[model samples]
Target: MLLQIDLQKEEPIYMQIVHQIIEGIAKNELKPGDDLPSVRSLGADIGINFHTVNKAYQILKQEGFILIHRQKGVVIHPDAAYLANAAYVEKLKRDIRPIIAEAAARNLPIREMEKLVETLYNEMKGE
Candidate 1:
């Protein structure tokens, strides 16, 4: 998957990597067991420090999104489809609550927020 990093954005570079990789998985552009570039290579390609890519890779590994093999390098997790366990659901809720709160604070009605979410989700799925 192609990744575009914006240095001007307030979000950190590693998060951008994490988001794009996950989005790629969501879009089925990155399939389970697909090999990924080494962290050093991706960092070089993105013009960022290797440690930053390492951090993103570590998070993906911890979250069961990717696997690093000593000899094989990195690949998308083969069981990625089984990742949405109870803990993951809770984490998802926790991660999104702040955005939901911000929409409420801005007086974006629930229906509007729902619509916006649907649009984004559909776009991500390439539907």
Candidate 2:
């Protein structure tokens, strides 16, 4: 997985890592059952402490994005389909409501947002 970490961002480093991985999954860059690098290795590669990576991985695991095996390391959860769970849908609304509200506040056009969503969907399908 390729991730860019911004050490200076107001958001925590672990959140950055988590978002990057989430985006990778959304973009199909990381498929179901794909293995993630060890926490130590990923931390070394990103020049961050291992605990940061571990925290991110634990969050992902808790969110059902990945499975953690004691001996096998971490792998994308085989059944980890996003946007399919009621609880997850609620969580997504909680996460996106502010963004949508802000966009509305900025007077961003609905048609433009629809087009962006269509474009992203097409890109994900490699269309």
**TM-scores of the candidates in the order shown:** 0.94, 0.87
RMSD of each: 1.1, 1.7
lDDT of 2 at 34: 94
Off by over 4 Å in 1: none
Lowest lDDT sum, 10 consecutive residues, model 1, at 79-88
Candidate 1 CA-lDDT value: 0.93
Candidate 2 lDDT tens digits, 1-127? 6898888899999999888887788778889999999999999998999999999999999988999898999899887676577887898899989988998999999998889879987887677
Clashes of each: 0, 0
Extract clashing residue pairs from model 2.
Answer: none
